[model samples]
Target: MNILMAIHIGAGLLALPAGTIAVAVRKGGRLHARAGTAFFGSMVVLGITAAILGPFREPEPLSPVAPLFVLYFVTTSWVAARRRDGSTGRFEILACAAALGTSAVMYWGVVMDGATTPAGPGVIYVLASVCLLAGLLDLNAILRSPLTPARRIARHLWRMCFAFFIATGSFFIGQQDILPAAWRGSPALLLLGFAPFAVMAFWLARVRLGKRLRASLQALPERKLA
Candidate 1:
C-alpha cells in the first residue's frame, strides 16, 4: 500500500472510534462540531483519493466508482445544507440510488468475477447502501412531523453521521487487510468483513442511545417520557 494511501485509510479508520468518544463527552456540543469537521474533511479527502486511485481494470463507466462516490458525497452535502422545506428529497433519492446502483454492480463483479478474493468490498457496498436508506427514511419522517427543535437536531445529526459513517466503513474495508489466509482469490471474507461495519453502527447507535438514556434518567422519572 502507498504510504499516503495507508494514512488516508488509517485516518478514516480511526475517525469512528474517535468520533464516538467525542460524542460521548459532548454529543451535540462544540467538541462534536470540531470532530465533525475533522471527520468530514477526512471524508472529502478520502473521496478525492478514491476517484483518483480507483482501479482502472473495470470498463470506463464502471471504473469511475471513486469519482462517483465523490460526486455522491458532494451532492448530498450540498443538499443537506439547502434542504430547507424538504425540497431536496430528490437528492436523497438519487444518492441512495447511486449507492445501491454501485453496490449492485460491484456485487455482480465480486460474486461473479474471478479477480476479487476478499468479499469485503461487496459487503461494504451493501451495508453502506442500507445505512444510507435508513438515514434517508429518518429524515423523511422528520419532515412529515411537526418540526420541533429536537426533531431538527436529530435529523441533522443522523444525516451527517450516517454519510460519514458508511463512507469511513467502505474506505477501511477496501484498503485494510479484510481477508484471511483462506479467502485469497475473492474479495469475500467469512463474515468477518462485517466487523468494522458492526462497530460503526454500534458506535452511532450507542451515541444516540446513551444520550437519550442519560437525559431521560436525569428528568427524575415523573417528568420524563418512558
Candidate 2:
C-alpha cells in the first residue's frame, strides 16, 4: 500500500512538469510530442495507482469512485488527441457514457450525504458539472464527426487541460498543507493552480482564429485563379 502511494505521488510529481512543458512548447514538434508522451505515460501511471488505492481509503466507496472519474477523463482526452476528423469509435462513445454516468452518480452522492463528507458537496458538484459538460461536448463531437482540424485541436486542448487542471487542483489546493505555512492559501498559489484552464482557453481561441486565417489565405489564390 505504501509502495503504491509513493509511486502515485512520484508519478504525479513527474507528470506536473512534463505536462507543463508539453503545453508550453511548439505544437507538432518532436519536443512537444516527447514531452506530451511523457506526461501522458506518467498520468496513466498516476491515475491507475490512484484508482487502485482509492478503494482502500478510510472512507471506503466514495474514495474509489473519484479516481475512476479521473481515469475516465484522462483516457478519453488522450484518445481525442489521436482521433482523426470524421472518426467515431466505440471507445469514444463508451467513454462519454462513462463520464456522464459517473457525473450523475457523483451528484447523487452529493445529494445523499455530501455535507457530511470531508470535502463537502461543493467539490462534488463542481466536478459533476465539469464532467457532465465535457461528456456532452464529447457526444456532440462524436455525433458531428468530420470536425475541423482547429476544432479537433480545440477539443484535445480543453480535455487535456481540464485533466491537467484536476491534477493541479489536487496537488496545489487540495494538498496545500504540504506547502510552507506562509504559502498556504496564497492568491498566487490559487492563480498558479488555475493557470492551466486559462492557457487552454487562450489556445482554444488562438487555434480557431489561426485556422480561419490560414484557410482564408489559402482560398485567395483560388479566388484569383477563378
Candidate 3:
C-alpha cells in the first residue's frame, strides 16, 4: 500500500477499539476521557491521510469527498463535547460552516455523477445529507442561545456516534476482504458495523425519556408538599 493508505489504515486500527472503549465505559471518567482523546486523535490523522490519497484516484473524483465529510463530522463532534455549557465559540461556528460547505460540494458531485457521469451518487448523497443535517442542528443550537445540559449531551452523543459509525463502516464493512473466510460473512460483522448506531439510539432515548422520568419523580415530593 502507499504511504497515505498505510497511515490511514494504521490510524483506523487505533481508532476502532479506542472509540469502542470510550463509548462503553462510564462517561466523564478518566478512562473514558483518555480513550476518547486517543480515538479523536486517530480519526483526525485517518481523515487527513484519506483526504490526501483520495484525489490521486483520478478515475474516482468523488472519492475525496467522503474523507472531507468524515473530518467535518469528527471535528464538530469533538467540539460539541468541549462546549458542554451550550456556549457557542468561534471554533464551533467555523466547524458548522465548514460542514455546510462540504455538504454543498457533495451535493454537486452527486448531481453531476447522476446526470452526466456513471458514478451515480456512490454514497455521496447520503453522506452529504447527513452533514447538512448536522450543520443545521449546530447552527440552530448556536442561534437559539445556550443549550440545555440534556440537549448538549444529546448533540455530543449523536455526533460522536455518527463519526464512529463512519469509522466502523469503513473498516469493518469496506475492508472485510482482509478478514478470515469464516469471519467475512458472519452476522457478528454486521453487528460490529451497526453497533455504534444502536448505542446512539439507546443513549438518545435515555437522554430524552429516562432523564425526564427521573426529573418528574424527583419533583413529585415537592408537588405533594405544595
Candidate 4:
C-alpha cells in the first residue's frame, strides 16, 4: 500500500509539470509531443495506482471507481490522436459500454446513498451526465466511421484537456494540505486548478472555428500534428 501511494504521488507530481508543458507549448511541435507523451504516461500510472489505493480510503467509497474516468478519457484521447484515419473499432464499443456503465453506477450510488457519497449528489450527478454524454459521443463516432480531421482533433483535444483538468483539480485543489499554509484557499490556486478548461476551450475553438488551421492540421502528417 505504501509503495502504491508513493507511485501514485510521484506520478501525479510528474503529470502536473508535463501536462503544463503540453498545454503551454506550441501544438504539433517536438516539445509539445514529448511533454504530451510524458503527461499521458504519468497519467496512466497515476490512474492505475490511484485505483489500486482507492479501496483503502475508508471515507471515500467512490474513490476506487473515480480514477476510471480519467483513465478512459486519457486512453481514448491518445487513441484519437494516433489514429489519423479516425477509424473506430471494438475498442470504441467497449469504451462506450464502460462509460455508460460508469454513469449508471454513479447514478445508482447517488440515488441509493447520496448522503454518504463523498462528492455529494450534485457533483456525482454532473459526473454521471458527463459519462453519459461521452458514451453517446463515442456511439456517434462509431456509427459515423472515419471522422473528419477536425472532428478527430476536437475529440482528442477535449478528452486530453479534461484529463489534465482532473489532474490539476486533484492536486491544486483537492490536495491542498501538501502546499504551504499561505497557499491554502488562495484564489490563484483555484484559477490554476481550473486553467485547463480555459485552455481546452481555446484549442477547441481554434480547431473548430478556424478554417485555415483545420486545413493546416489536415495537411500535416500524423507524426507532426499530434
* Best-matching candidate per lDDT: 4
Cα-based TM-score, every candidate: 0.49, 0.86, 0.88, 0.89
Cα-based lDDT for every prediction: 0.53, 0.81, 0.82, 0.90
- Clashing pairs for predicted structure model 1, backbone only: 116-186, 116-187, 117-185, 117-186, 117-187, 118-186, 118-187, 118-188, 119-187, 119-188
Clashes of 1: 10
RMSD in Å for candidate 1, one decimal?
7.7
**Weakest 10 consecutive residues of candidate 1 by summed lDDT:** 56-65
Candidate 3 minimal-lDDT segment of 10 residues: 113-122
CA RMSD of all predictions: 7.7, 3.4, 3.0, 6.5
Q: Which stretches of candidate 2 lie over 4 Å from their true place?
A: 58-62, 112-116, 213-226
lDDT of 2 by residue, 1-226 (tens): 9999999999999989998998999998999889888888888888889888877777444465556666776677677778765476898788889879988888887787654356666877887898899889879988888677777778878878877887888888888999999999999888888989899988998998877888889878554554
Residue 206, model 4: Cα distance from true site in angstroms: 0.3
Residue by residue across 104-193, what tens digits does model 1's lDDT show? 666667567733434446544564465456446545644564444344444555555545545544544543566464554444532333
Q: Which ten residues in a row have the lowest lDDT in candidate 2?
A: 59-68
Best by TM-score, which number? 4
* Model 3: residues with Cα > 4 Å off, grouped in runs: 57-62, 112-119, 221-226
Count clashes in each candidate, considering only residues at least 3 apart in sequence or on different chains.
10, 1, 0, 0
Name model 4 segments beyond 4 Å from true.
Answer: 58-62, 112-116, 212-226
